[model samples]
Target: MKLPLSRRARSAPLPGIVGAARLDIRTKNLLKRLRPGDIAIINHLDLDRVSAEALVEAGVVAVVNAAPSISGRYPNLGPSILVEAGIPLVDQVGMEVFARVAEGDTVRLDGGVLYRGEEPIAAGVVQTAESVARATQEARAGLSTQLEAFAANTMEYLRRDRNLWLDGVGFPDLATDLEGRHVLIVVRGYQYREDLQALRPYIREYRPVLIGVDGGADALLEARYRPDIILGDMDSVSDMALRSGAELIVHTDREGRAPGAERLERLGLRAQVVVAAGTSEDVAMLLADAKGAQLIVAVGVPQSLEEFLDRRRSGMASTFLTRLRVGAKLVDAKGVSRLYHPPRPQVWPSVLLVVAGLVAFCAAVAATPGGSGLLESVSAVWNDLLDWIRDVVT
Candidate 1:
């Protein structure tokens, strides 16, 4: 169940519960015991929009997210969905705060006293969900007001700058259309070799267009598979991969040039440099999605905020927007790999085969008793030599 945006300043009543709910369940399931006007304590205020349906129906008043779910990166599903469902959401509370105040803690949100639990502990409220909801609303409203200008500027950035979005977009949405064409996308680092091996069958079967994103080219080459198109900032990719016989799409920045682009030109290879302000992976995904590729498979790509943090990138908002725009046509290779249950040779079959080989060897030994005796003599002689050597060495 999902929830709608709910506000603390509601004319009517609140949900049944009035405390933190770190547990994520259907609003109906949650509302079975939880009443309207309850405060929800979640790990992070990011819930699937579909999941929010229940909360809105139940009329939850406030919510608190433990981690930084949306520091303005991807859209905050929890707070946004909750507030849209008439609920408020808070962010960045200490981990101990939830434990300090259990299901029935008396907490203050939106200037209202909510008795979360009768015997719950005390959790000092830093920022209330009510305040977060108001802030989120204002920020969204401000963005909406500037949407026209932002979109216009984004388009201008695309045109003047070699946006990653346009790289390899000549055949936008033409994956299946490129039927019988072998299109290879490259990804370097670990698991990509396995990825190529996994995709080899598909590559051989479908033979669609191939585009490698940076080091992805190196991975392809390692697997003895040549790439037809390579796209990325070219930082992680090898010089050999950059020089590989493929149509290179150098991902540039807003200033219209980057070292990668220059390197491609220096190699006498004129790349379709895309000057976009986003991650190379995002640009590659958007390009493939727009190119109408029958399928887009991402390998070893950062999928979460933690992963993004590992890379220390601050362009998640741009990347998230790109993903939102083209998420439908994309397929993450990792997710597909999770579902792979390749048929393993049955233990019985392997055992039978081993037994049969052993039996055949024994039969051969029996059939050639003289030869078997020679083999035994040779083994004895070798053992004797080893024994003599061991004594002498000692």
Candidate 2:
């Protein structure tokens, strides 16, 4: 007796990849639950580079997106990163996949189709490197539109937060002193890990007041350094990092509603609230500048136009204005790492000093009786050692 087509499909050599499915509409929340080799199912649209990097780091074997990964919205960087990492990406598989597939369900990905047992649960377009590139090229044509949107967003942010920017309003005073001190603000963003590694020497020399914005606190702890202050909405940061003795400053909305404050209260911890309209990164810089920081070094903060837009939020306008507010004192971590190399001690000068000391000792000995004979014996021993070295080299 012949089996049904579905059974036959399942029996016919299982050609593609299989993994446990992990799904969430919120990509950041999903990332926390994702295990290595799990099939990541997300609803993220126009995936940003940071999220893509997080997914890659999570070691997902494949990705199934419910929404378009690239909607041709100004060259989002996530798809390209996933494609380059050799992970299989199935795009726009629709939201019904969430109901069809449960978390931890074993699923098989064959070309663009997702399978459970023998039944094809969802099907979508398979994204390749070539496809991602083409989509990115097409998206570039939309940059002008994005730029106009960005400008409008900037004006909106300015109108809403002019008092905070101009008068330093809504900034909470911190116990961690920033007066005339070099302050290092770390954010968990692009190349943050590498930038942190590069800033080790500067960090050691200056011993700047270390401030970690959200997950950046964990980054500092991972590098074996405790944060002096932790500032952000407190969403992405670990509980251990919060209890790591850093003074906490929660960034709240303009109405003074701090989401992080509730979480801190749950943990039996207290935090000062700063009611601000911008992103935590921008607020962190503003805090440093307002507190009279002599120099502010930024690590893992977005530095390019593409990165600024990649944030996909209007808050980037505040970053622009914040930089202008503190541009003189602000320095990128990359620049500091590249240009601020500490002077190494010269071996030649020490060698010359030792040689001069030896000469002086020999002259003093020569004034004494039998000094010439002793000097001749030492010279002979040195000549013999040189001969031995030369013979070994030959």
Candidate 3:
């Protein structure tokens, strides 16, 4: 027995939803140009949930992925999200579609089939809720292998970067003074904006040193707070964030190849370089620890195994070591937000009472025998002062 098509599937018009399409080879770059009702053509392989969420937020009618949405390496949730959001996802449409179809072209989708017009162009596997669910189940079955690989990679990284764990190796001297101060390092991760909002009061009160890691710099700017120090490889950060007066620390490869620093130099901007073999988020933490920050509050840090995998990291070796080194000083943004409650003011009631007391005192003074005489004296003094002011003006 065959199951009937879901309401989401049947609701889509038979001749297919026709819309203007915009193509971008890079999904992240594509996001900037996306608009509601526009079809998004992207060449993303094993598309992650974050990219999928961005596409959903962009309000695209359908997605045409040139590469496989899920290659079965792990249970990626991106394709599932699209199908659930009622956006048709056409997977593995081939790379040729990029050149064959021009940008801003009107495209029509009839189920799994794509058409430029009367002419049929590209056809692909249309992902459905049921299909995505099956794929996800199969992918989850292969997690043991992924866990083994992660463990091996972690050990290898531990061996290579042992010096960092034991002693703070190659920690650079930054111009920003961080001694005995709270350092807030922002990483672009899940719910980062909301976490920043939750920490707004803490930021206003403590006035911590803000460190932005690459795209995290732009996140800070989005929240209307300027970063004091921007650290990363500089690939994802915007030009406006770079020019936001934050001191730039470009993370360089072990071989001293700094693509980010070079980019800044070409743009006639100065940047400091730190050669490290770990993720930039780890670099930011280690730098803060070395600089003697009293506390390091991290926003949008990758805390879970899935989050680490989402970043395409083999394991969380660098992150684990970085945390070990920072020890007691490092705290997650969520923890601080939960534990610290801003004081609720009771001063207004006292202030109102004092104001009422002053009014009553004035009323009592007015009722006294000398009140009229005092008022006359004050009025005469005011008149004399006014006359003097009038004379000076004249």
Candidate 4:
């Protein structure tokens, strides 16, 4: 069972087969060269669509997830990938069980008994193997179609928005009148984690101006980076981020009054209300460029066409204009995490907010009837929102 059969005879010992070697060592080796169409043993059910697509394309027939049985943490992209690819997938197998079958072990299947080296670990839901093959062809076709549409949208955005590329514009031009020597832009969402991780190392070396656009403020705070400024409507940003050391810029419409700007003033966080036409991210970039920022690092800025489609943005024209406004000072945070090593945050402000929330909840519950009801709803909603925030940050 070591691998493909040796020339001598049927008497050679395989690497992870019975009597050949210990289980852990064998399993590790098996993992090193794992290919598609093999039984997959996993640790969790949750997987993103990207990873799932990769596994399916690789042709892995099944996966053994070791995660909690019912977390529903994410879609088991792997299972769906297997199903669509016409491969078979099963879940929840501990590592101890999977080690029993090695690269060349013999195993039983529905239609026939087959060598482990040749057959996948599980079977698809469809009764016939021929049906599985057909499904795989269809799934691949569908994936291609989806990807094509994704590509078309992305190109359309780039075409509409000219700022992603600048001929030679650089630092000095992308700043406001007040002028920040350093500037950081935060765009909140799943991409924020990737962006922050990329920019974390750079923050220490170059302390730029910090500006959070709504949820981006939460992102900045999560990374332990103190924001010097925040831009956007007040929605999605935490009160703590607003109150934290940054100045606020409330994005408004052409009418010259923003409800969000009014709220910032009430909190004693003075703000400039800018009436703009695009998203908060676009405005933040535009304002930084206008403000004369020497260097601007934008985190979680969307680039792909599929991403724009998902966001349902009208086009890339606005962002393009903003980019041209900022010029060459802008650097994408999407790739930053790969090369940066950021410092650990000394502040536990986000964690403390949880404690403060609980205390507030207790006080509210102990107060009037109306207060208790209000606290209950707020607590649940706040927790759900916090969970979403946690997802974006980590």
Candidate 5:
């Protein structure tokens, strides 16, 4: 007897990629709940590289976006990364999918279509490498528009926060000393792990004041280094990192509304608040400069134009202004790691000195009357010990 479609789906082997559906509008928040072999359903548009990298790290089997992953917003890096990682991407499934699909529901993705048991719930265009490449190429034409928008945003930011750039206003006083010291600002951006590993020798020698921005604190902890100061919104940071005894400085807006402080309060911890009109990265740099740091080294901070744009227009503008404010003192980690080669101690000289001392002793001993016979007896004993060791091994 033939069974119903739902019964058949239950009894028989279900076709296509099957996993639990994890849904969230916010990509960063969604990342925390995602697990291996789970299908991620997100509403992110024009997904950036950082988010893509995090999603890839989460080991999600497939990504089903409620909106377009690439909306021709100057070739955003996310879709290509997902395609390269071999994770199945289904784009523009519409917002209805969120309502139709429940969290932790068993779902099946066959090509572009999403199925719940025997019923098809949603569908989208399955993104491939070729399709993503075409979209990226098309998106390049939109760069001029994005640049114009970025310029406008920069002007607006400069006008609103002229005091911040001109004078170090709203920078919170910190317990961690920064005067006449080398401050290392770490951001969890491109090549952060690699750059941190490369800077180990410099870190050990200089013992720079380490400042971690948000998730960068976790990065420092993972690299087995304790952060001197932890800065940022505190959304991405772990609970353990918050309780790590590092000085916490919450980045706030000009009005002094600190959302991060609330999180810390919930955790039964206190934090100093810094009101600034830029990103946490920029604020961290400005704070270091304001605190009289002699030299500032930036690790995992975005260097390239594409990287800057990937963050957003406002962020790019803030980064530019902040760099100008802290000029001559700022250095990239890549340059330092490449150029700074520490002097290594020579081992051959020490070995040679020990050999010379032994030879001198032997020569003095040989000058004595019965020294030659004594040396011969010592050599014989050494040979006997070697033979005995060899025999035991055999």
Candidate 6:
């Protein structure tokens, strides 16, 4: 028997694909409007894995890039992921394609050639697994230079954010007291969803102060957990997550300008504003450490050198310095999941077991000769009780 094709297989482009064109030079911005079955026209160079995953999740039928999908820049894996998902990726079709095709216009992809109606608009390379692999291998040759630049950026970051490390720079008082308690800080990165799944038992047992960093709040909501605290620029989190009664803290730079604060004001929600340098995740860790959290568990925090670079951060100095400040108390989500064996089953299960045993005993008693008379007496009492309830209703 032939089974139905999977969603990926069904959505996969045929020899010729026709779909509504959706163009965005900014891949992140474009994702907001992109719908499944729409063709995405992006100008992303060296497309990072996170953006690629977002495109896949958006369910775009195909991708048309004005820029090279992989420019031999340190083995970026975005293109390969798209191709592997059976989404056709046509790249380097020149910037003119943006001008030729209007948004919402019907566009066609005949292999690497893009067409609007009968007229062929542009042509470019169609990426494949083999080609992506070759490009990745070539990109690795440039890693040494990237490493040197990263080191210089880290040193510069340390110099600029010295006050953060020394004075705990601007930690705010929170209603949720974190002292001697575990704190879970989540960022929407990597296998954050998977990490959250692995942490179900931990969250249930410790009831840690749950903190969501921007879009990470939505991640928590998706996992069916309401955040205790939501922090960041507030751009990516949903209004539902914001209104879920989680305390909001808007992340700001040393200048104290919070972009997220204005958004909340328009929504009629109040939030505490925090000023600091570095990414919001850095701010979150420092805040948790200063608030006297005994243990800080991070989910989807960027840990590797490649991950930070993939995020296109100029320096990880703040991250490095923040980690140092929170040393001994910090633990990765993976470590928490693996090292912390789930606590023994709790009171509810024992209560359930006792209830089941009682049910069995009652049934056995009802089947016995002497207990039959007792059950009959109880049934007559129950009928009389129902009659009384009926009389009261009348």
Q: How does each model score on lDDT?
A: 0.57, 0.91, 0.85, 0.55, 0.91, 0.87
TM-score of each: 0.42, 0.90, 0.82, 0.42, 0.91, 0.80
Tell me how far the alpha carbon of residue 145 in candidate 5 is from the true structure, in angstroms, after superposition. Answer: 1.2
Write down the lDDT that model 1 would get.
Answer: 0.57
Q: Check candidate 6 and list the clashing pairs.
A: none
Model 5: ten consecutive residues of lowest lDDT: 252-261
Worst 10 residues of 2 by lDDT: 308-317
Residue range 218-326, candidate 3, lDDT tens digits: 9999999999999998977888999999998988767876556667977788887777767888989988988889999999887776666656555366776677788
Clashing residue pairs in candidate 2 are: none
Better of 1 and 2 by TM-score: 2
The digit string of per-residue lDDT tens for model 4 on 203-247 reads: 778777777888688878888887777777785577889888676
Across 1-394, the per-residue lDDT of candidate 5 in tens digits comes to 8899898877877778999999999998899899999999999989889989989999999999999999997888999999999999999999999999999999999999999987999999999999999999999999899889888888988998787777887677788889999999999888899999999999999999999999899999999999999999888888888999999999877687655667898999988887677799999999899899999999988888878877765677888888999999999999999999899989999899999999999999999999999999999999999999999999
Runs of candidate 4 with Cα error greater than 4 angstroms are 1-180, 255-259, 265-268, 337-394
Off by over 4 Å in 1: 1-184, 338-394
lDDT of 5: 0.91
* Residue pairs in collision within model 5: none
On a 0 to 100 scale, what is the lDDT of residue 285 in model 2?
Answer: 92
On TM-score, the candidate that comes out on top is 5
- Per-residue lDDT of model 1, residues 1-394, tens digit only: 5344464344445433344443332232344445566666555433434335445656566665555435443333444556555565555664665456655545655422233433333232334455556555544544443445446655554554333444443322321333323234455433466666776556665665667787677777787777777888765567788777777777776676555666666677766666567667777766666555556767656565434332323454455566667665666666555665455558998899999998898668757848678768877999999999999999
| Model 5 TM-score relative to the real fold | 0.91
TM-score between model 6 and native: 0.80
lDDT of 2 by residue, 50-127 (tens): 999999999999999999999997788899999999999999999999999999999999999999967899999999
Our tally of clashes for model 3 stands at 0
Off by over 4 Å in 2: 1-12, 255-259, 365-394
